[model samples]
Target: MDYDGILNRKPFSTAKDEKKLMYGEWLTELTDYHRKHCHSYGQLLKHLMIPEHSHMGEEEIPMLPVGLFKDMDLISIPGNKVFKTMTSSGTKGQTVSRIYLDRDTANYQQRALANIGGDFWGEERLPLLVLDSPDVLKNRNLFSARGAGILGFSIFSSRICYGLDQDMNLDTERIQQFLDRYTGKRILIFGFTYIIWKYFYQALAKSVQKLDLSEGILIHGGGFKKLEDQSVSAHEFKERIREVSSIKEIHNYYGMAEQTGSIYMECPKGHLHASLYSDIITRRGKDFSVCSHGEKGIIQVLSPLALSYPGHSILTEDEGIILGEDDCPCGRLGKYFKVLGRIHQAEIRGCSDTYDG
Candidate 1:
């Protein structure tokens, strides 16, 4: 598939009315394309008995459990053409998903990020403040989810500073220096949710100093289980951060290494909305059928961006509800939903056992 034309367009530019038909055609083509090129994926589809030329709507498109990536090297591209392999941050002793990408796919991922990042941070690059230690990026080749996230968004800024010390403490002196140097300029801050809450916000909250970052934009994501375990809700997370840092513009996104560039960003109204690069469908736990708005179920993510691998359609282990469509109070023209955290006992499997026929 030629991604040049698709990547050139701004992210989330498609209207909701047009998406059904547009994505319907695109996803159908991609499914057949992957089936023909990926031998293992073809076998899996046969096992599921999805008939050839099935005319089901986008929601019925066959999806592999996201855990399949950890079990097998699922790729559609030739081995020689593969340019990069992205691994998920599985827990200790757990196997991780290895996502393969050719030159085109990798470039497309960057372009998608650029478009979406521009939408959130504006076109101009800002002084970037990373909440992790610098050592995370030193390896250059392998990446945990945290490391890849830092590197992926680094393209938007020339000046980068790590906000954490080697011991993972809040380096107040370093952050103060960054603020002083970029005074009156818009800043971009990136970090995982729990890390920001524990290391950055808590540390700063305990300090006597007040830092005003009201003009800055903070983009954070990753699993929120850690925070929930500590009794920290998203609302409280935002409130505490604002109380400490004075940073008002914050967006928490939902994304995975499996579908690198397709990020569902939380709008100002606090709903995560999908973009043109991807779409989300909630499935009932009982029958794997699509759920209605305001209904909670497993989240099935679909994206055309995973051309190098069979990650186009994936049944993730997260639960969520489709709150609304085309009518987000934020005025974004797509489906907006809420994540209710990961399914219990879902992470223990190197590969998820659940399957959608």
Candidate 2:
């Protein structure tokens, strides 16, 4: 599928009424496609098949989280295109987002994000300092998220600052020295969440040491799971990022290696909203079914552009809510949802465990 084309073919966001129609049509198509190709999901369609039902239903497909990845390889592409494979960072033998692509598929993901990133920054391209390295851009076997998923999305620009440290440590000297040499440059510093919090935040905050960076933006996607033990709330984490970089905008987005082009970013209003290519609904939640604003529930992501994998209409483990379904005062249009936490095994959705999904 021309994944990027599917996303940018039309205007992404729409009025609430229009979005409903759009989502309905998308869900129908996704369900039909999954029913045809996904072997395990096909079994689900048969089991949940209803009499007189000629089309796919929104609630019929059996939702499987990362647990399923431990058992089998869920892929739709030919084996020859399997550029690389990855593993779930959870317990051993867990499910991971298996990524495969040719140059077009790879470039599609990058162009989509770059278009959006360019739209947000109001620039054709910004100098990006990747928290990882050019190794991620190499052809050798590495984690797909590192090699293709993250780095691939960043290929639209040529001004890329790379990390040379093998230990993944943010070399303060390397970064500052580069910034000092290349002043008055607009940069987009990208990194995993806790990776920045662990390595860069304190160092930057140590006296509010501002670099010569003229205009820099931060886009981090590495989930907070790595720092689950470090005790950092999303707000405090952003605050820390602001405290260190002093950048007005620091977007903590939520995305997976599976769904290549669809991702949700935290708006300036502090709510993470679904992108145009994706939709999120709360099926069940605490105290009641979280069906509206201020209601927290399990987040189910629906991405129409997920033609490469089975993440088309995935119900993730993250617990979230549809904060609002309209244009925010912040001016971002689309569905808004905040990720409260993840739903852990055997734990009730509202049991108040620290992290589950």
Q: Which lDDT tens digits does candidate 1 get at residues 218-270?
A: 99988577777789899989999999998998999999889988988888899
Most lDDT-accurate candidate: 1
Task: Provide the lDDT at 10 for model 2.
Answer: 35
- Report how far residue 356 has shifted in candidate 2, in Å: 21
lDDT of the candidates, in the order given: 0.83, 0.60
Q: Which stretches of model 2 miss by more than 4 angstroms?
A: 1-5, 9-12, 50-53, 56-62, 83-88, 91-95, 101-108, 133-142, 203-214, 226-228, 285-290, 346-357
Pairs of residues clashing in candidate 1: none
Supply candidate 1's per-residue lDDT for 343: 79
Candidate 2 to truth, TM = 0.82
Per-residue lDDT of 294 in model 2: 71
Candidate 1 segments whose C-alpha is farther than 4 A from its true place: 53-56, 348-357
